[model samples]
Target: MSEDTETVSVHGREFQRTSLDEGVYYAPVAFDDREESRLTAQHEIVSRIFGDGLFSPRIPVGEPEAILECGYGGGDWAVQCADEFEDCEGMRVRRLSSRPMSRQMDRPENLDLVAHNLNDPLRDPEIFKANHYDLIHSRFVFPGIKSGRWNGYIRDMRLLLRPGGWVQIMEYLPIIQSHNGRLTDQNAVRRWWQEYQGAMADMDRDPRIGRRLKRLLLDNRYRDVEVDIVQLHIGDWSKNETQASIGRDSVEMIGDLLESLGLWPFTSKLGWTAARFEDLMQEVRAELQNVELNLYIEL
Candidate 1:
């Protein structure tokens, strides 16, 4: 381990800086219209977990000196949160949105949004120092962690939090994006997502995010650690146009992501064909409307 790096554990999940690899990274597609939709979709997921505008009776609420928001994709929620808490908002930065959203999120007074790549050398420890932020919030950062990157990521987050300050993280469990309302057959579609998981394992990756967080947090002696698991049903896509539309968009994004990430470089691995992939995703879109994936963890 480097002199600057530190070990962090949560719920028994141990992370070392040496475990964070360069390969466990993602650069979002530049300015796709889909970005807004996906952000909205993610907000729907997170808003459910955190509750709209941070008022949740089920969760602990505190007035934070500074708030650290990891993965500020569109800064939609961050800006909204900043707008609400006059003294709470701090810099919300990400690698890709670092440039564009940096300019945009700066419109608000309390918000100091920046485009910072986490993989780069962190120049300012004060910006992410320990015992600093009263609230550290992260959503769906697991995918970005790749395989070996959780240690560095977790350490970075732990440093940002003030002692006894709350750190909230929410992640999707596998069974990615439920779809298809029914009619033709469900067996084959289930197998596809199962194959997807195998492919993730094949790539030395883990998609289940919330699974390890509880263990990591408790192991680190974070007090009052709580995890709430919620399953959200998007509605039956075949019956509801609005739900179906969202599911279709999700399916489309998945297909694009599959192509972009080389999800099936070996055609045999996924049984991938351009037409077959699209068709299979459309089938998924139908199922996702009424389906719900695991929304585990609020640690």
Candidate 2:
């Protein structure tokens, strides 16, 4: 393994990392590959969400010389792109708190990983060169950044991309909507989302940022901006194996993340004790187990 590949320990977890800002933000997810099955499943879900091809009309099919994936969790998307576009160089950036980089031993030589936080603008002299990239992308990065920073982040993306270059951002809408108007206030998952929004509100992060990306991009003067919203079933409710698998993966993943994504923020910002949070989660888990619940999320 290369020297940089060595894992570092933080709070009993082992992952490679770069220096971080003193008190920037907290990340609830762990970076261990053992906990990353959901991330792989997420990429598949996203591909299905857009019917494949990375969801940007401005980006062409042929290889581009440069690509950047901000918040490049697990590097799956970057590696896949590297393999498809053999001559293209791909750079991925992530914060230290996102856990570890992907562990693909046979990764392409053209793919590079860097530890850089997206909450701030690109500052490295070489990376900051104006109009230096052919494409830029990010997925599920809202939780780790302050709500107000997205405008600045999009502005940075605009500066990094060359003329006619593409920029894509994918985020889970985080709201539970039902097709038949069955998702009532009494539903546990619906209640869970309510609590989540409340906690995020207290923390000043916006869980609804998914719906605002189009306006943010256009406000930054990005031309030809397009937003694709994909609706996915919450669990095995969809009967189709692929959709069920995607839903199952999502439920399982979020189940694993409940503590980080749910408990911590709620406890810190809303003043709920762990015991009290668990009580609420018990009700929420019961709702998750109902196949007939039929909840769907927009991506």
Candidate 3:
């Protein structure tokens, strides 16, 4: 189906509204300063968690001749990666709901940015040549891809990769867990997460896509699939200095995410009043600060 895109304002935030039959690009987050900051913090946290690596694939694909990063939020990962692989040509594909194009300036000379809806196929054969890219990286893009279209999405990635090319995808599990059994159904964090998951499911997006990535890749005949899971603490709960630092960042990021990510979904999709959503977020934020609960999220 053809898509007509327009900028939309919701609750003092901006989102890209697209007219599509299948309803791809369902991300509820705004494309404003808060969202950009959140993406930046998330990138730093994930990089530290993974030992500052740009990409993760055990079987080395050697020096990538060309790289493609889908859902290049805030363009942090793409810019850093371009610097790491300075000689390689890189393309950053931003979703329709990403920040303004003007914000993407000052990128590396070898890095090119393109605005595209990932749910649809990359139609520009001349630009997106068949089996041309050596490495394809995507992170936190599952929300923009419909659940039923994962197979088609994987097929498209395969078509874009060279024979030995590697594709790295990183996603976060929607559920929140506790190291101890302190977290219960009555907890505000758990309640908010449940609502968030329901909203995603209602929009035909897979909230559990992180856990399903390995199976999805293997089923698509992608050999040697590797799964890496990192647990992110919600507060300064860890005794280790590095982990405590990460947890502090996580608390701040998650607090911001409570509003940025949940504002639209909870209010729009779940039929919640704006005031009610804000009240719940307050409680969730407070709950996240409790080191005693030992709450954490898996990525």
Q: How well does each candidate superpose onto the true structure, as a TM-score?
A: 0.67, 0.81, 0.89
TM-score of 1: 0.67
Ranking by TM-score: 3, 2, 1
Q: lDDT tens string, model 2, 1-299?
A: 54334454433334343322232344433355543665676676677655565655545745577777787666667778777777544443222223345565345777766655666667577555578777777778777677888899889889988787788788877776776677788776777788888888777678899988999999989888777687777777786887887787577555544434675566656778767778787876666556676767787
Residue 299's lDDT in candidate 1: 25
Candidate 1: global Cα-lDDT? 0.50
Give model 3's clash tally.
Answer: 0
Candidate 2 regions with alpha-carbon error over 4 angstroms: 1-25, 52-59, 89-99, 103-107, 236-245, 257-260
For each of the candidates, the C-alpha root-mean-square deviation to the true structure, in angstroms, is: 9.2, 3.9, 3.1
Q: Which tens-of-lDDT digit does each residue in 183-284 have in candidate 3?
A: 889998889888998898898888788888888898888987878798898888888888888998899787776677677778878999988988998898
Please report the candidate that would top TM-score against the real structure: 3
Q: Model 1 clash tally?
A: 23
Which sequence of candidate numbers ranks them by lDDT, best first?
3, 2, 1
Estimate every model's Cα lDDT from 0 to 1: 0.50, 0.66, 0.74
Error of 2 at 181 (Å): 1.8
Position 287, candidate 3: lDDT = 88
Query: Cα lDDT of model 3 overall?
Result: 0.74
